[model samples]
Target: MIEDIYEYADPRFRNLTLPNTQLERLYDGCRWAEGPVWFNDGGYLLWSDIPNQRILRWTPEQGVSVYRAASNFANGNTRDQQGRLVTCEHGTRRVTRTEPDGTITVLADAFDGKRLNSPNDVVVHRDGGVWFTDPTYGILSDYEGYQAEPEQAGRNVYRIDPHSGEVVCVADDFVQPNGLAFAPDGQTLYIADSARTHDPAAPHHIRAMEVVDGRWLGKSRVLAQIEPGIPDGLRVDVQGNIWTSAGDGIQCFDAQGTLLGKILLPEKVANLTFGGPRRNRLFITANTSLYLIHVAVAGAQYP
Candidate 1:
């Protein structure tokens, strides 16, 4: 019966999902949920409730609890190489790191002497670099973050050096960069442009580019174009497969950017992450609820 939730575009996708496992609705009541990060050591998961301005924690032992209130409208979250939680705050328009002692460290907030437009999604490189996407969604209205004028000339993707603490712009040509992820080997970077969120004629595709010298990027090419919705957040598996959020549910693509399959849900999905002990549990954040399902493959990002 669980197999009924999936639509296979490619035969390979059938091997990625399990038939016995059923999709579970973990919880609901969130205004908007995003940014799921799993901690293996603690056996817990943390995600953002943007409109509610809180970060909710979930565990198999205990259902759900408020991890941090007044979270500054956190959007995307990931863990650095050091295992510290790295977060993108829409309200503060900055990227931050949560230390073991529970204190927050500001990693990046501005570039070229101007304040950043709002850091959306973030990812950490194995080499200790902090990368994030800066878009104007947080400043466009007061629902998620405060309504204000964007200070940056363009939405850009930035990388914060591990050793120098220097912030550098890596990509500058995007209508609205939302989610981003790195390949297993950290050689290729994938970014989702959700410009169609406002303008229907804008791009609605995920771009793939070469990561040069851990700082610079090569020419980008459209890896996959989405329809019926835009790509919001995405994650890559060990095989270099990409799983991204869509209007209907989740769209999966193989390394070559081929449509592998789809996980269908009743509500539109906002973001997703792979978790569980084996990193095979796909945790999804939809409009106002959270869902989970088991997968056959493990996520490239480990605990």
Candidate 2:
């Protein structure tokens, strides 16, 4: 008997994912797969194989190829307003941007004159600010990055001023902030704390914060708690729904943070993003493979 992958908690979730549709396994053969980002302009998807220390690219025309070999153990990636590739490097312990000409520019590597622990995930705000999470996962072992002592006082979320080039800590109370994204309206930010991966008493939920004046974060509230696994990379759909990666698969939450449904996969999902021409294709990075499924929603495009 075939296992059912869709778990519908509400009637609306039935409309998001089709019951007859099949989830496609695109590629595999990685120690740890993560950070799937889609580029519509190129009609391809890029992701990191952290333990392999390389970034992989995939297209419908071509199956999979090495995008960057010496990737410095990159973790997360996103495109800026200018279409430049913004990435978080674990081995280097910094956030960087790949220019249009393929040149690399160091965006943020230290805070308060102290070296960063390890940049985990990143996203670009509508205001052109580069926001990212600094966690110690990369420095805790030699598997993904060089093991070393942390320099910063805590794992925090930071924002880089697009004009001034100054980095500021936006949130500093997280045990390990992993993934983040803004709502379609750009008025709210959702960040995931996967601290439960290290401590059972830590948060295993995602928090939603109102964007204050497009700069600061207002009072945050727990949006949803993940079970059987912690929340990792996340994305927001054009309809304002949140799609987050969890231990089992991807969890779908409505705008109000209600658990709508779940897409259960065989492997633990690390990250996900919407792609394809209409942005209806959901691309996921699981433990050692990349998966895709056609959904009824489109991803919110940031400017």
Candidate 3:
């Protein structure tokens, strides 16, 4: 059924190839997993099991291990411009960074003196700034995180200056912003609105906005409307293709927002990242398991 839902041989994806490569199941048995991050220095992959309240690490040599227990219900993670580990914590309702020396630093927990609802996905810009989405998905119930009063009226996306601790609201009109990533050229920012909790008639969609002078300055356009499941997290390859995790599996789209291919998995995927020796291996966190595939594309070289 998933194969039927994600077959790419359709004329709509003429430029894409539906590789016969088998989808390998790496690991499983997780409770609400999300946020797959690649660490080249350690040659490992890290992901979060929010309901389990732990961060998991997997390596070819050591297999899977608990990287951190009680990880504050981390939801998403990425490497900063300086190669530090940045994370979104649902339990803590903040964004944090893990320094090279293994020290934890709170990046942004509140804005305008009010606590953030819950930090979700994060990405770094070429200008040494960090951008992340904030929604109440983690705070809406006790399954992912402890439910608490929303410190703000609406959810928003924010940018944090790497040099200064200045945090600014970049986008504030989304019903529930989830995954986000920049184009390879950094001129466009793509964000996914799950909107599962509000306005059911509004289909979940991925939208793109132009970046001007380091700020989002254009009207948002719908790139793709997801059905059955919503888009969760995404990354851009060097060729400008978008690798995003949807309800069925991971979907690949060209720069023009045309669906290219789909990597269907047995379980629902939450997030993923490109890593490995060549940076062409896609490490996916699906449900409670970790899966990977070698692709013909490379991820953006963020340094």
Candidate 4:
């Protein structure tokens, strides 16, 4: 039963999940699974195995299969307004798009004549803009990516103009920006800071910001502080709840920044996304495996 997988901090959380559904592991064996994106056309899910340098796919009819090998150590993935795969690559230190025709197009790799530290996570706005995080993690170690020094002076969140092909720095003060997601209405945005890995005492919280004129308002307020583990990836539901990865499992928060409930996992969750036919199923990419669960709410669908 869902009760076996979740612990509720608020009674309202009871309505969010079913009493009979349980978490199911779809596949395992990856060194680390970080990003999980669903393809509506084929009803399959694609996720990145960062340390393995591969992207894996899963479907209901078949189990897990290699989606792309030597995937540039891709970390985060999403679909654009045109339904193409947009990815953040640690090895390549770039954000790229996989076209429907099987061609790869570089979206962004550098700014101000300097190479990016490493693009970590990415999201596509309905406005056709591509937003992503540039963190030093990929360049800091050889396991996830090649070891190197920071090429850019600051780690910042960037927005790529859909038409102008220009990259703009939306926020620049984060030590390590990890996961990000937008509300269904596109008015509010949430981003997680996982800087604690380096500082040990750094703030491990998800920040909220207002989006104005398709750009981050440049001001942030802490939405939630995750203990145990930092948030890596997240997705917004139609009800505006923020579902984020936590140390032991996934936590769901309401718009008021209230902790609603948590789905407990034995492994540390790295990231998650809402997928499936109607987007009510949540695809979770934990440390070394992919898990799924049926939820009562639907994922946000933007026009």
The TM-scores of all predictions, comma-separated, are 0.98, 0.98, 0.93, 0.97
Candidate 4 off by > 4 Å: none
Task: Give candidate 4's root-mean-square deviation (CA, Å).
Answer: 1.4
Candidate 1 per-residue lDDT over residues 31-60, each given as its tens digit: 999999999889999999999999999999
Against the reference, the lDDT scores of all candidates come to 0.93, 0.93, 0.83, 0.90
lDDT of 3 at 300: 80
Q: Model 4 over residues 189-295: C-alpha lDDT tens digits?
A: 79999998788888799999889887655557899998778888888999999999999799999987999999999899999988888999999998889999999
lDDT of 3 by residue, 84-123 (tens): 8899999999999999898899999999889999999998
Give the Å shift of residue 145 in candidate 2.
0.5
Model 4 scores what on Cα lDDT? 0.90
lDDT score for residue 155 of model 4: 89
Clashing pairs in 4: none
**Among all windows of ten consecutive residues in candidate 4, which has the lowest summed lDDT?**
212-221
Candidate 3 segments exceeding 4 Å error: 1-6, 9-20, 197-199
